[model samples]
Target: MPQATKLSAPTAAPTPALPVRGQTDHLRLIAEMTREFTASHDYQTIAHSALERITRYIGAEAASLFLLTDNGETLACSACYGPVDITGLRISAKTGVVGRAVQTREGSMVRDVSEDADFGASVDAKTGFTTRSLLVAPLNIGQDCLGAIEIINRVDGDGLFEADDLVLLETLARAAALAINNYRLTEQIVQQERERHELELAAEIQRDLLPQPSSREFPIHGINIPARSVSGDFFDIMTLPDGRIWFNVGDVSGKGMNAALLMAKTSSLFRCLAKSAEHPGQLLNAINSELCETNSRGMFVTMVGGLFDPATGRLTLTNAGHEPPLHFDLRTERFTPIPADGPPLGIMPGIAGSDGYAVTEIDLAGGMLYVFTDGLTEATTFGGGMLGIDGARALIRDHAEESPDIRLKSISGAVKLPGQSLRDDLTLLVVEDMMTARAASMPPPRLEAMSTDGEILRLRVPARPDRLKLIRAAVEQAAKYCEATEAWTFDLTMAVDEACQNIIRHAYGNRPDAGDIVVDFIRRGDCMEVHLMDFAEPVDPSKVKSRDLSEVRPGGLGVHLIKSVCDEAQFVPPPPGIGNLFKLTKRLPSKLQ
Candidate 1:
């Protein structure tokens, strides 16, 4: 291998100084080139124009700008200016004078190509252009060398390159290197911005595809939280025309756009086919066959789909390599896990066998069924440990007494720490057997004396803060009907309002879907008895106590407010189908009695 002679500034041959007019022209040309580089972001156009001006200024026959490829193993001619066009020519970084300049990060001037053992004659032979002398300057920005600029065969002054030419080329190479680097950086930034926008749009579309939150009394409910702008996990709930509810939870194999796309497809397929498909197993088979046709990346989806008949408290489920759904029995407080029975979708058509994925029939029997992606079990808990299956069961057991919507939120929120990202896409779906819960529980007993009093007013509303106003109106009207004074009516209304607030905050955990509240007002001669009822868990009379007035606080005031205005304020025997019954009796004025 032949090595070219490197030229250092201190040892370069000296040349005669240019005249004043010539010096002015050179300065003007360099200024113009710098302005062009700064104004335009196109690398090739600017490089070619600069090469033409450089070749003419140096009185060279041909000039070519070489840039290192991505791998840095070879130099390719990015632009050229001369009679012969060698724009796409490539050569090894160690084989020619131009390569030597870049590798050494210095300039090189060869007076005669034949005398230099480092000269590669293959380019001259291929293009039929004879090269005698050449000047090469490396394109450098600080200590980094990009490539080199090679000027071949000087057309003036005995056809030999001078030292002045090498100096000028090096100065020009710096400007060109800066321009190329800037263009690359700008291009990269634009590409990233575009990708970010697309991801956000995809995320919005995914959200629109999901079902809205159902009412608290509905038997099926679900929640989804993505780790990134998009998620690979998805869940869908669709109610068929025949009253059968179709629900599913799925996990795509990877993350980002590819996984998000697959999630969308699978969710769409379930929604479309589950409406008409008779069984969960056969519906999954159809989706699997459709996905196999276009899944070129070898990706797959693990899903569990089920059809629930609310009338029978029966669920027919089909699992395809997904996490086993946990069935929590409200009566026994036991968990039963139903594991997958087939491979994941998109692996191959009919991989679930001729009958499709195996179906598992479950009798919810007043219990709750939970379907979730691995994101839940793999999440990091506040205790700095992975929430494995045991942790997941604990979350479920803790919140099992709450409404379906609040239960799902509490379970998912337990692992979602503040100021931290999720490990994966989290999705959870719940199916409750409303029939069993209704049949097993009994209605509250009513007080005989108040029940007989003609039923002055009755109102039932959801247990929400917004519904408290309506209850207050009913209380005022009932107090007015009994001919109670303005002061008495105001006190009764305020007392009832505080009672409802306590039910929303304590019994329902402030959850929007926390069942309903029933109020009954009766006129008992000179006294008005108002009964407030809720269907939440039974409250212990010992635990329900008014706080002492000595210590002032924001809360614990509702109970005190209720007791202060009423003659009797206590939990009474509720009517049929009620959980907690609160009774308040206020005496009428002396004239009415």
Candidate 2:
């Protein structure tokens, strides 16, 4: 049965005024209690003091304060001056004199309790006290009957209980109820602390368990985000030697600690393979073999891995049922996708190998690449409608010409609403081209195999902090060089700004004290791609893995803007801090800046 609320009726009546000598003293006492005790924040302490004070102030032999619990069915004695055991006694708000007054919202007084039908003398019987004049009244505030207050056996000169006495007791009851209510609120606050603490602990553990970033003067990057207190999505970056970079992003099928732990193992193993210099397909095979043996929960991970050559700006990648990444052509100012095949990790590890992997190839021919988990596209609005793939792609196109910060703000701002909660996680990545990046003395490994419309300008630059500006200037210049119209130049300029800033901020993270970054720009026959190679720190894109940005913030704003501004962005981590490549590709003849 649903519990009844305390009387939701008229407000408590003020005590009736009467002509009496001690009335002034009684009023003063009541006022003092209200100002000093009831006004204090602690309610229970004041309640006890109020009853003890009423006993002495009113010249009553005994005083009792009954409080109604939230359910209102029981009125328990909260404080009693005459007898301590009265604290445990319960009164029914339905039948007892106190109950009837509280339920009916009335006040009753029995000058001689034994002669009054409403008076119950059992309390006096238990205490060996004679029946005497008394006052019982409901303690009400607003519409709630908090309980009742009673004064028994007036002393120090009293001819029966006068009307003035009833007035005084009523004043005391009002103050008492307010105090009691505050005490109940405090109790609720104390309980919430425990739950909040646990959530904090869980959130901390989830963050701590993620992969430790690899700080190397190489090319590779990562991102991650937890869906809840713990995350099911993660990524890792490890740079090997010989211009080879290794990185992977993956998401567990479920959420929470178990998925987080599973993500930890996958990330660790994937990063550990940095020593092997394995190709994308080979690495997935090895990891799948391990997961096939250990993934007892039957859960799987949608994963993607890649090996990037900073010198060549070539990314050899393998995808495990993850999203099909975008490939943008700077020359044509058009976009498409580079798809990979294989099941999610742990879904029969050997499945892809038995069937042969479906590999999609694209030339980072001065262009961009983008990869993401379902979280980004699957994020829902407050109205329960998902942003979906079309929304994510449309955002990219709409702001493809805006500044990175503006683009980030636009995408985030598009979803802002009060009091709405995100239903899932969203994670996305963009790899931009850093124009004027040129490095000499490289082997010609089939440049013709790559296709570009003609906006690409590939260069290889030495690793130096001062040279970063040169790369940025070169990109700005390249934008002017390739654009058929001035409008297209501004669009490319924003892409250049975002890509260079990311290479400086995300890749180097403002660590000028460390070392400088290397840059390369590849202008294909069809489109232009800018490549920024750094040997700073590589973040696992998985860190920004799965978060529901649809409703609220689960991560930072940079990557979101990168996705919105550039046609494509891809991260490639090379070995020995050798290659940390940031590729940004913009389709030529694009929208105005």
- Which predicted model would earn the best TM-score? 1
Runs of candidate 2 exceeding 4 Å displacement: 1-21, 37-39, 85-90, 112-134, 153-163, 178-388, 397-427, 431-443, 447-593
The local distance difference test score of each candidate is 0.83, 0.62
Candidate 1 lDDT over residue span 1-593, tens digit each? 01122111212222322323266777887888878877886767888888888887777777899989867789999999776778989999877898899889998999899999899999877776778899999989888878899998776568788888888888778777777777778889988999999999999999998899999878899999999989999998888887889999999999999999999999998988887788999899999999999986889999999999887778999999999999986533579999889999999999988778888999886577999999999999999999999999999888865777888999999999977889999999999887424543424423223343546777778899888888887787777677678888999999999988888888777888978887778677678877777888777768878888898777788888999999999885432235777888888777734
lDDT of 1 at 264: 94
Candidate 1 ranges with C-alpha deviation above 4 Å: 1-34, 128-132, 155-157, 436-593
**Cα TM-score per model:** 0.69, 0.48
RMSD of 2: 16.4
